[model samples]
Target: MKPIFDEPEQYQSAVAKTAEALISKFGKLADGKAWEAARMPNLTRSERAYCEAVAVRVTRLVRGGSVPA
Candidate 1:
């Protein structure tokens, strides 16, 4: 397990992998900036849609309090 922000390398790698997988499964991403774009406070409709589709996994990721490290 890895803390998304505390562990920068792992976080970016995870995001890249997730983005690639998302692209492969769902046509194409509206805003293809997987790294920088994700840091934004507000995501576009397409990004929101993609996140909402996968939000259920957040619980699995959370261990006790944080996202595992």
Candidate 2:
């Protein structure tokens, strides 16, 4: 079995891919509450957190808010 915290690259890749897909589907009107309502059952808590962060960043950017560096 894979060790916890041993696959950062894979984790980031998965998050990025999922984020892109979510962005494409939701576009500029993406809503965190709506996304949470439709959360994927297969993702772990950490994965969900990362995806939610991406969604928040996207939403902020779309609304002309600056994302923190």
Candidate 3:
């Protein structure tokens, strides 16, 4: 388990690997910058759509028994 905000080399490596795998499998995210854009406090319709899509995909993948990392 990683400590919060530790930013260890292993953690960075794992994040990069996971992102690569997800992008490769999903073929470019629909709202790649949604995370940062969502900090506006009032999300737009497209932002909501992007978040929902991401949640659904993640849930389906987890339910499918492919434990990420």
lDDT scores of the candidates, listed in order: 0.45, 0.62, 0.47
lDDT of 2 by residue, 19-52 (tens): 5566677776555643674477888886677767
Maximum-lDDT candidate: 2
Prediction 3 global C-alpha lDDT: 0.47
Compute each candidate's TM-score over C-alphas: 0.39, 0.49, 0.35
Best candidate, TM-score-wise? 2
TM-score, candidate number 2: 0.49
Of 1 and 2, the candidate ranking higher by lDDT: 2
Per-residue lDDT of candidate 1, residues 30-69 (tens digit):
2343333444569877565445433322322322223332
Tell me the TM-score of model 1. Answer: 0.39
User: How does residue 38 of candidate 3 score in lDDT?
Assistant: 40
Decide which is better by TM-score, 1 or 3.
1
CA RMSD for every model? Answer: 13.2, 4.3, 11.3
